[model samples]
Target: MVTPTESIKWKRRPLSTMGQTYKALNFEESVLCSPTQYFKRYIPDDLFTSIAAYTIIYALQQGKSSFNLPMYWDTSLKVNVFWENISRDRFLELRTNLHLVNNLEKPPENKDKFYKFRPVYTAIRKRCSDLPIEENVCVDEGIIPFTAKFTAKQCVRGNQVHGESMSSCCVESVLLFQVLKSQGINAVGTVRQNRFGKNLPFSDDKTIMKQTRGYCEEITSADEITMCKWLDNRPIVLCSNFVGKGSVDEVELWNKKHHKYVKVERSEIVRKYNHAMGGVDLFDQLISSYIVFIRSRKWSCV
Candidate 1:
């Protein structure tokens, strides 16, 4: 079996067609945006700091919260970090019964883990819950690198284009949903389009999302009929880049059309990137744009 850790180590995992265009965040920005409290509860400070460093970079590259690649990459690496510090036997024990580890003993000093990262997850979840909830959830898709290498034979559904391993952009979507679900928000991940005919990691049919896991309501733009069900009950939370200030109005129009409003959250690590590259003007146009994007949307939590 391909352990999660090994999966993250392979940078080629997420089809490297783009030459690292997604720059990482800088140190100051990274330090400023601390990890959620859940991480502090279990992961040791130093180790957690390292993990946070990588995760912040990963999150920035992902552009927003996600699952497809970044989610797996984060989990896999933490798993590896844990295994490397502790023996395989102990690792298996914890993997089998994570709760016990949380309640009974301290994590192995050398190993790092995110399995019971309730604090971080909780923080994110708590923030999401505070947001308005609705019945009809909106689902969309965006593309990001897989951070791994897979050949044409491995994609399972899409055309096997060389170099890039076509994978679902679920990391950001799922992360948002995970947080929402924790707060009793019934949302779902729906596929807007499938340029390539590949099965989603959690889906069985390319035509519709396979509702197999998680509590959030799942739908795909392809399933227009089913999607309407969420119109009144689940408010839409579309995941995309901060196109500009106009995006907020666009979301409002969308809400008015469906009797629900939309909330847009921009997740870019330019500040982090600038810090990583040691750039000043830490308060330059990029940061200002990000701030303006957040303020315009009234996304107070950001």
Candidate 2:
């Protein structure tokens, strides 16, 4: 049997035709294509193909030091001529008018915050449902930077980001976890210390490190869910239904006082968490690096 880690190695098949690419892009075509009395604004028939071409061109072209819309249209720069094919006004019009959900009715209670994104979210979930998931899947929270004021916006600290932001911790995340579980996929994720309601057996008399170590030992040994917790500057709780207690590993940490590398013991859970929780972070890093620095007030467009 193939191990979970080894299952990551898979072949990629090329999309053979324009129809395949269109299908991939238009996940909600069935719903969006059919114009209802309430939701009369259906997507333009050729918009998906146009958007795909536009995105490909945008990805290929390099931007100026201060990336802006004008740079692409400047004839002096070495830019793709594709921009000339589609007028800027037409592009803006399509972007402004793109509707996912019916704007005619009030969104259902408690979901007004994400109502604008609901259609795209549904499309994404549909796409995920069709794909074959790996044996081991990991879940983690991510932040989409939005400086604008919104009801569901969250504020995260210790990064370049500041002010209000939207978070990915929602019903969708729970649904994804459930879907993966039902498919017999092993899932793991980091949880906030305060959010984890379990009572730790540690006492006030014990040091933080000792308490954390004790908790890790207790959970790894006895937890029915195979859940575990560990400390790395702060507490990190994780749940893994398939992974059992694993052997300990050690790492060399630099001791500033002694001016030498000191060996520190690390739990198997910590190693696993580090390996599994980085997928979202890695994706964020890649996208942020090549981001087209266009200013848009619309959160959905950003």
Candidate 3:
């Protein structure tokens, strides 16, 4: 009989398969799309019966994201966390042994930084591409929660953002904007100071902040390219082939040190970016709300 380790190895690289009319697909994107999709694909007949039996009871018992495993195994009742359906040891073994892909088949070290989630991420990218393309679309990175220790941990994590990322100012310039303009597409986005034209320079955030909070600087090219920097709660720089500094309007901004909202002058360019960028934020918010929570160190499991 094949042992668990051997079985896992076999899964990582399937040696052979029984005769089939078509390739057997173990992992399907729709299965990961929704709870209903998951139940439909995996356990259609037993889905409702099992959920009615155990799912609601466990959910009512505790928080959705707050399952404590070590605590569950504790001998003391006062400190011990409990699950009605499974023992802690058994659950741990199940989690540790679970294999979506063979570790041996992982991409060479550093070649693919996130080899673990490649399949899931590729699937997500595929699904995102299948979505209807609009003239205005924004690409932002998605966050996958890792409760345990990891090397690539970052302080910031937000919604299920995914798409084709816009190039940084390093890759974006008057030349690139001109190309977009030639294609009848106007581009406007936030830029960093280091790569934004050196000949056309603006004061740093500290210098700008030292002046009136509404202070701003603008440089417009003969061909209509605009480079703008404004100081509000912070210094922000923007570059575009089309939009430039227009009517300055007052908007409320939270003054953190003062603990109140203060009126700050906002230019038309900033206002337009804020209004349009809402589409990206909305996309992230909607998908993030429905992400399935799987308790595993692997980002792909989520």
TM-score versus the correct structure, for each prediction: 0.20, 0.54, 0.49
Superposed Cα deviation of residue 4, candidate 3 (Å)? 55
Give model 1 RMSD, 1 decimal. Answer: 22.8
Rank list by TM-score: 2, 3, 1
- Tell me model 2's lDDT, rounded to 2 decimals: 0.46
Give the total clashing residue pairs for model 1.
40
| Candidate 1 lDDT (Cα, 0 to 1) | 0.31
The top-ranked prediction according to TM-score is 2
lDDT of 2 by residue, 242-289 (tens): 443356777776666679877666765566666766777787788678
Candidate 3, residue 68: the lDDT equals 40
- True-structure RMSD, every candidate: 22.8, 15.0, 18.2
lDDT string, candidate 1, 1-302, tens digits: 11221121211111111112233333232344355654553444655554445554444444634322311223455777654455554433323322311322445563434434445554555655654543232332222223243232223248432222223234332334334434543332322423212342322232222331111222222211111111222322222121101111111223445576554332122122222322324424444455321112111322
Residue 173 displacement (Å), model 2: 13
TM-score, candidate number 3: 0.49
The TM-score, computed over Cα atoms with residue i paired to residue i, of candidate 2 is 0.54
Clashing pairs for predicted structure model 3, backbone only: none
* lDDT score, candidate 2, position 56: 41
Tens digit per residue, CA lDDT, model 3, 141-233: 555544555555444426443222322233344566666666766677787555544545456677888887777787655455566788877
Candidate number with greatest lDDT: 3
Residue 170 of model 3, lDDT score: 35
